[model samples]
Target: MKKVLSIVLALAMCLSLAACAQNPKESTEPSDSVKPTEEAGIYTPGTYTATARGHEDGVQVTVTVDANSITDVTLDVSKETESIGGAAADKLKSQIMDAQSAEIDGVSGATETSNAVKMALQDCLNQAMGVSSDEKTPVADGTYSGTAPSFGLTSQMTCEVTFEGGKMTDIQVTEESDSATGEWFASAQELFIPRVLESQSLAVDAITGATTSSNGIRNCVAAAIDAAGGDSSQWYTEIPKKTDTVKLEGYDVIVVGMGGSGVLSYCAAAEQGATVFGIEAAGKIGGDSVCTYGPMAINSQYLKDLYNNGEDYINADDVYNTWMEYVGSDEKADVIHEAVYNSGSALDYYVDNFGFEFEGMGLLGSFVVPEWTKLWCVYSADDDNTSWNILGPNKTFQFTRALETANAMNEKNEYMTELTATSLIFDDDGKVIGVNAQYYDGTTYEIYGKTVILATGGFLGNDDMMNEYLGSTVSTIGDTVNDGTGIQMGISAGGATYMMGTLPMVHISQVPHLIRTDDLTADQKAILTALALTTDQKMITTEGNVWGNENQSGTEDEGITVEIVYAPDYMYYVVYSQEDIDNIRTNGLTEAQANATSQFLSQGGTLPAAGTPVEDIDQILQVGEEYQNVIKADSIADLAAAIGCDESNLTEALGGVDTTYYAVICDSYAYATVGGLDVDVNMNVLREDGTPIENLFAVGQDSEGVCNADGKAYTPWGGQAQSWTFVSGQIAGTQAAAVAAAAE
Candidate 1:
């Protein structure tokens, strides 16, 4: 009888809908019924209020339903505007009446409100369908235990659950870091309260700093009731036994350099399970990379082909044409370009898999129009080849995808450590096998592995090697370090060399010999220390004098130590008198006082020489010929004549100088050296015969000749050692690993 009634009712409703087309207003809508004032004694459709907390402004909503139809919806509390929740609420309310079930779609812009409405509707619908208030939640009243894993480390946990009428009411989170991580536990408790009471679920996202804590709590709670037979896997999954320690081995592949390229290769080999090691005589890691200030050109034919289709101008339309610009007729540069272009793949792999952050390295002036400064260059964040630079949203030119590929191999694997490689151990066949390391012990240890990588850094510390390899004062140009440790080592063992000729300069700009960094700002350093291309020649200085190497008047002292180069930080000052020294050390005193103070001078510029009177500056200059002050000169005319500067330009430049500023600058300042290393395609050290030695490599500023086909150009400075250290190190590391793995 009820089935028949349902069919009859459905037909009658259809017939009514057809008849209503004749008079649309004749339909009996629920709101059109006789309005009834609220009478306490009378029965009316129950109005349920839904509320959501933790929102920025808080939220409240009410819906009135009559029979199986929604009468009205009102928002009593809200902080959102029409563009957000307001607009969505309007659309949602209109569809609520027609939704026969709780499977209605949510509003577009109002996700939170939509969810709230869905839950509210679910509640109201249950009552309407007569589902009774006897529904029950899952109970957690048993014991559970499990292991939490991360970073190849596993922690254990156990919990006993208690429940109230089939609903979980309490939970406890314990961990090894509990004593020292109380604050993290407090914050975690705050977040966990909602998941248990509101959502009635225990699974949650891991907390940022308190990852271990959050995971511990979740795993314990999740496993508790499951061990009571709720779900077996929830309590204990068949997890594999973890590996905690790695054993040492004999290296099979050996590398002998630690420059940008060398380190990159070595790191690669190490990643491949090679007992990778780098040998650098320098105290620091960055070699020529630290001292360089420019970038290299890497061209990908395929990417260029794709770029040309767009509005951007790329060199890929013609491979030979693009090749001529960077490589010219020299096939070696082409080989270098091919190697570099492909290298991006590996870099991309490294950044995505490892924890590397890339800021997009691409052409700087390629897309810049003379009239428009809005868009300058093309940069990109292309883990999946979609995102771009914050400034230029178009594309990227240089691709580090090469490194990315190698890094991805360990997507489910782990690396043991990131120790700085110090030296490589080689075998008789010239193949690298292992390393001797300055491991945390501060003493050398013979680490036996299958492969050895030489990314120990460059000879930024070997001054003689720089002069001998590049045939110039490459050492005096940029970093005092950049000595050619890699080159010397590689050459001693037979390696090819190329591009090792001129010491690049930042132009012929005359920079200060010594600077006081304590007072100078960054902009001041850029201007004073950078190269000046407009000029041709530069002045040299030695120990505050024109003849720093030796005073002719005092006889040869230090063999003409005229090293007119930039200071480490370009801020070297001298102070005297305890009060003045303490003033600088303790407080600023005052702006005027600070500006007027001497940063690179004592009470007097010079002292009495032998029996000369201290008050007479001229007399002291003549008598103090043996001291560093002998090189000091008051005017550019004296400086030019003393240091072999052109007399005419000296007078002009000196005239342009504000005497006060020039006096301070000439007396104390900083200088920057732009050029140094030169290398062949494979980065091997060349013998005097022009051929590379077997199984030898050099990287960083150890040897000149990486750039400048015609002459000297700026080096890729700063993290130069850092960039190549990882890149070349990785390669060497991987090769070493392969060798080791193969030997094993």
Candidate 2:
């Protein structure tokens, strides 16, 4: 009887729709005698709420369903990335309503959040259909393959899962990208993959500094679980953490970081017979250093013999003079002198004793002046590629070699990963002693040592500290785990800071959440890259104002860095028209004007050749729209409305918009923070009153400001920061080792 009534109701509804269409002006409201059918539609009319795992936390979806259609949908993706996932709410909601079902093409760039919304909405719709909620899906005993977005939003990390007797037996990552630091990704694979299998859960903590890769692996497993007919959410079982305390003592020197600087410090201290304890907040040893190309060297024997026939490639005297001139002051002249003169010698010492090697000499991406000396040298890698393999992945193995060499020098020398230094330990006279740290699993550690070196890379990862010091925050490509604990520890020990508000190392610009090369073909990626970099058309900031030299806040007179750093939201948009698209399809991109290279976007593809027409121009635009990196409209008014800006301002910026228009977004990313704790020539932390903290030292980004000025650009050389690590780390380690010996 129920089935017969459902069929009759469906036939009557079709007839009523036909009658309404025939009589256009007829009232469609039901009469009093024709009562509306209750509980007869496919779906039980009600709102349903469901939750699914997002990039970081649970994404809640509330869906309203009427008797026959999806009435409305809403999402709460607050825990996702603000500019990426969080920005896709409206689009996702609109997609759900338009499809009238959970079947929807998700937004690009925010793939994780989009997938979560789809899964949660599907659950809600299933509830509306009166599906049994008490029953759980059984996992089929078979192997399955799945994928998820990894480091790059558009890149995929694939994994194969084996299921036996309704339990996951093994998982093997079939493919992964090295866009995230290679060492960090390896660390994630080494630690994260096994924990999931051991716990039989997806709630394991992500490896520090390798969160993206860890999440990628977890999501891949979750996808495999779903494919095997099991509820992925059921595996998000919480794991308990132990709250215990541990104490470690008898170390002569403690290094509170394991990146380029901290590793060098440990090696230098260990060479001096000082027992060293190294603490790293990340899962791996190399932090931002793993992603860097190389470091600056003056007249290192390798560069001198290979490039300039053993004499000096460049004079040290000129470097020191130019360095002082760049800062426009002699405030930290002593430290600057040490940085310039000792850079080569420090690198030589590491090469001779610590097994470090530099293959060739070249210029860095962020050089100050074209005519200046090519002081930077590339770190040697296994395979030779462009620029002496310095920019390749194998260069990170050099740090590994250094750490191994250091450990062999002293049996007591040790390093711990996933341990973060919380604060400095002080003695009765308020003198710095050791450090207080916390393990990732909630264990407390109190480590004592005679001297401490602060080298936690800068505080670019700390939002509050960035706001407190630099007054603004930018997208960082550096390790987000390198908070300001080292600098704060220095300050707690009466150490002052130098140029705390200096500009960051902002060198690269691309579309927000850059789509990886694997996601787009060479031609499509070339077109997108061209759209982002083309200055042929008028460009405007997020606020609808024309972007020009007048908007630059950089202290540098001329450079792309200044323009990008000062742009609104650190981004701008290039407006194109239907005519522009037609031109691109017919003729070609303004190849010369559009060839500005963004290393991140051009990783695995080449830009279209000049005058080579891009036939897939429209397809590329569609992709840009999907990624929310492009805005398309039919008129100037629509463009303004879409961009959320005033039409008048946009008109003034672009003169006028005619026909359909597309606005392509361009965003900037930074490497790390520039300024940090003040230090003396010997790399000892200095108090506000110009006195040195006897047992405290700062290096790398923590003391980088000693060579830079606030409000001005970083010492425009790319390898300068890496060079400082060697110089400052060596000086600090040697000085601290001497202090420890004297105390004994």
Candidate 3:
């Protein structure tokens, strides 16, 4: 139960307790279509006893009503669970007054409770709305147990209904999912006894979305009626409201993940002057921002800010244009326009006060953006050279600046702890208040806070996750260290999911060894070795047939593709030699043929590995069977054939290779996949019906990745590790803060 509440609250996207413009016929025909024969105005609203309980304890409620609305409501049961039900109770009363049943909005903290209450009320309303109360047969009115399915998931509950002389005079306590709202729902039993006794029959409502609890409660009543063997249910009845609240321990805000987005959210909240606690999922503090290589793409106004002391900085428009040119995709949303138009001052504020870096050299200024995005810069391997450090002549400084800003915020907020937030806890009112952290030693530490921002780096950090969701049967080409634990936990909890397929992390490294031992195709191996000589180039698709567009579904697998880095031999199991790789890095090789001569000496030993002399290759230490996945070819087409690519495109791209861009490509790094997730602009995780989860918010990778297109791509986009981590985190933290503050 502890695990469910904490984890489920964060990942609460599965439930759709609220309905908007829904087709009522989807459930049942509306009873309201029939006309009331006995002047409906003369009917006096009656009280209906109700019992709602968790699997453990049950609560009783005495609900009193007049006419069509509830007048007085009281909870006669519930002890330990009362504190968490305030919001649910308030919303329940409000809903009964203005709206009756399934037509109401979902309660945040008391989601299940509100739904159950609505259903209980609907049971009575359905009867009152019926044209002939006597014609309404008793479909259910007893102590019965059943399971209700919602969001493709199911929950179980128990119900007890009572009927005496035809009308329902009493209701008994039963089970509910919201262990907290037990008293409020159960209290209806007492106040409703008189009405149930007087009426000939009564109709009741079922909980909205919580059909299980609703059915359980009604079944309890039904069982009581069946025990009496009477046809009951024809009077008006209502459920009580929740009015108490439960608050968590210290701190106003808790931010999950610590990469760029997490940092930004923390900084923003701290800037707004709130006491905040920053939580991370990994053992380290830096999510993905710290590992970035270059400045992020910015708009023109940002460029204007850096011009003040122009010794070095970047231009925002350039970032946009460069991205469009390189990625050759049209998805960029005119960041230049927004930055140039509305974000000038904001850009200046970030740059001047936060020390945000801006790069303007190399393609850093003229760089092209990929059609896809994950959250990092795509270029800048030259930074390792003497010419590209933060202050170097060729280097522009945006990445370091952002990190500086985050650290500064941390410094200012001494109370903040960088704990990994494994789970989130929400009060019954449907507001987030606390979180759980699992330490490296496998111990879990609980943190109670007002709000939390998820900035955990994307799923790229976890090896297991990569294989589970991504293609990791082979070595992962990107940052092997990126695992994305925070994102996984966040998603599993209902925080919502997004952005997983950004830059494709080539999954196999020692693939060749897997041939007989692990299973790989011949062509899959040769292409890998052939491409091994270039920069960080990943074979994402084979002629665009298998993965149409870019793995939007992450379902299809065409021919094999490889993610090869530009080492002496492309990023491969074995480069002939470090010097040979250096030669490719320096652009000194005469021809592709010339390069193949010593391929054997460059990397792994013989066939037991191919291309190299067995003795010379064997000299290098090796373990399992021969390296089998490596590829070798004299021409691009041959190479293309081996790697499962468009032979024609490879031939063309190789004919007149751009030495400047292709030179010395280092390996790539992947933080998480950013693809499809159902969400709204407010960063709210929504049901297919478009209603928000009360306390649920998502930030960082799992949440962000879902919104982006599948097979998203990023190039050395700085913070590629935590690209969306910064922005998405800001949205979650701020909103979570708003919800918490409102709850308080």
Global lDDT scores for all candidate models? 0.35, 0.76, 0.38
Cα lDDT for residue 642, model 2?
Answer: 86
For residue 272, what is the lDDT in candidate 2?
Answer: 89
Better by lDDT, candidate 3 or 2 = 2
Per-candidate clashes come to 128, 0, 164
lDDT of 1 by residue, 87-137 (tens): 466665665666533344544323334434444444443343332324322
Which is the better candidate, 1 or 2, if ranked by lDDT? 2
Kindly indicate the candidate among 1 and 2 with the higher TM-score. 2
Decoy 3 TM-score against native: 0.42
Per-model TM-score versus the true fold: 0.39, 0.83, 0.42
Query: lDDT per residue, candidate 3, 1-744, as tens digits?
Result: 121111111111111111111223232332323333333431246775554432112334455654444566554333212322432465456655664332455343333344345334433443332222234334344333222211111122334454433445444455433222111122233323333344432233232112223334433443344344332232223333333332336666666655556666666666655566666543234433433343333332545343434332444455445445533454434422332222234434445555654443233222233332311233232345443321122212343344455456544342222233556675686555677765422345666776555555455544456556554422222222234554544454454444354444332233222211111223323323333333233332333122222533222222223333221122222323333434433443334422331121122211222233223222111211113233344444555665556756654545433221111112222324443233454455555455665455555454544423344343333332233443454455567667667767
Error of 1 at 43 (Å): 99
Model 1 TM:
0.39
Q: Write the per-residue lDDT of candidate 2 for residues 516-561, one digit (tens) a residue.
A: 4244665566568778877677788878898866677753564444
Top model number, TM-score? 2
Q: If both were scored by TM-score, which would come out higher, candidate 2 or candidate 3? A: 2
- Model 2 residue 222 CA deviation (Å) reads 2.0
